[model samples]
Target: MSATTSARSARLGLRATPEQETVLRRAAEVAHKSLTDFVLDAACRAAEQTLLDQRLFMVSGSQYQALLEMMDRPESENPGLTDLFSRRPAWAKE
Candidate 1:
């Protein structure tokens, strides 16, 4: 079934192991959402990320140059991102 149809349909069924079900329930409770809402939100985010990772991106020569220029630019002076990077765990360092 298409993603939209499957997502909207009320009668669709999914099976999970007891441990998996427990994890899902705990995640739902932590998010302060109903089980259905939690599962749907999580599933949609995962699906979108998977699709974005798998898709091949194509760009015109000008677009490619623009991207290259952006990448080559020095890091932002913004404190929030710099602070976030500076606080990375020791294990995160190469």
Candidate 2:
């Protein structure tokens, strides 16, 4: 379901130090959002970034050159892959 249309039925509980709570409260006030909203938004954003980081990587110049060389190589014949690609996808079939 789309974010705006989805019902928020889950409950979460967390503890924070007084100083942290004060800061979060002030920031939430400045952002014009409830404390729950501010925390949830920040947590979701951080979770997204963490997941994305898992799929992304940085390589040094030598590693990059190796990757480029691999891409430059000619495609090898793979009968299994070729067969898979030649068939109509299940969803596309009547």
Candidate 3:
């Protein structure tokens, strides 16, 4: 989507310590953005990074071939993946 589009916009409420608030305010001023714009941009960037980390993969040709080989292999008979298949705590899951 184009950066100017508001269709993807989401309002978020954040509580920061006074020092953090002051730092953000100063940064917004220096960046020539309104506080809302600065905060939104930062939030968007953080969200993008998080999504990319989970959904994207990068590798060299050899690594890619190794990954393909691993995918083609039959499932392991070991129990090592049991924990991975079970419910995981939020902090530990990802």
Candidate 4:
């Protein structure tokens, strides 16, 4: 974790059955991590995987071709996009 991420201030509470707690504690010991660290790391990994699963997709060959064709198409004029791009981004220094 980065310095910013290391300063965690939120709290999460959970309950597990005795069997589940024992298994988790054993796994934490085997990994040489504190119980909280082990659970947080495992949970973060799981959360990342879950989010990636939602955003990523498999495309058929024809569908992929369609996507490529769309990308290769020329852009149309748009007043909104032109106006939007005219200004500098907020994060950019003058």
Candidate 5:
């Protein structure tokens, strides 16, 4: 279901100065949306962008080729990793 049509049970509250509220209300009016709708739409966009920043990345073509080449390399071991694996995990320790 679309977000607008979905059931909303959670409540979010925030504080803003009177000036801020006035600016927001004016912008919402200019945009032809209710203050609540305007704020919720903007907040959802910001949240989506923040999450996409974590999960998505961009690279140049040359950089992408370099990454592919690195992944194609034969597996090799490091002493540090070997030592780390030899130790007991923190959760397993007394």
Candidate 6:
């Protein structure tokens, strides 16, 4: 087997109702693919689409510039953080 084919040593089992199996079998036949290949291909495409829809994004040049400008703005001071600077380092005191 080719490396790509050999890499798929894991097995997955899906138990479908008879009607669902019939539908999937017919689709596999129409696509000229084995049931497993058809299912695997479709499942992978759907998974990619799902992840892209939720996680991946694109921004226009103007939007990208706005994000950059926002990040470039000067950092604001926090009262609690500034208070920490007055203390000496513990290792130095030791």
Residue pairs in clash, model 6: none
What are the per-residue Cα lDDT tens digits for candidate 1 across 7-91? 5756658999999999999999999987887888888789888898789787899999999999999977899878888896878
* lDDT of model 1 at position 86: 82
Worst ten in a row by lDDT for model 5:
1-10
> Residues 1-94, candidate 3, lDDT per residue (tens digit)?
1255467465568799999999999999999987877888888789889999999988899999999999999987767677667767678845
Give the Cα lDDT of each candidate: 0.83, 0.88, 0.82, 0.89, 0.88, 0.85
Where is the poorest 10-residue window by lDDT in model 1? Answer: 1-10
Q: Model 5, residue 38: displacement in angstroms?
A: 0.5
Error of 3 at 93 (Å): 26
Q: Give the per-residue lDDT digits (tens) of candidate 4, residues 27-92.
A: 999999888888888998899889999999989999999999999999889999999999899999
Q: Ranking under TM-score, best-scoring first?
A: 5, 2, 3, 4, 6, 1
Please provide, for model 5 over 1-94, each residue's C-alpha lDDT reduced to its tens digit, 9 standing for 90 to 100: 1156257667889999999999999999999988878898889889889999999999999999999999999989899999999999989958
- The runs of at least 3 residues in candidate 1 whose Cα sits more than 4 Å from the true structure, single-residue gaps closed, are 1-10, 56-94
For candidate 6, which ten residues in a row score worst on lDDT? Answer: 1-10
Clashes of 4: 0
RMSD score of candidate 3 (Å): 7.5
The reply for model 5, stretches above 4 Å from the true place, is 1-7
Query: Could you tell me every candidate's TM-score relative to the true structure?
Result: 0.49, 0.61, 0.60, 0.58, 0.84, 0.56
Relative to the true structure, candidate 4 reaches a TM of 0.58
TM match of model 6 to true structure: 0.56
Kindly indicate the candidate among 3 and 5 with the higher TM-score: 5
- Candidate 5 accuracy as lDDT: 0.88
Better of 2 and 6 by TM-score: 2
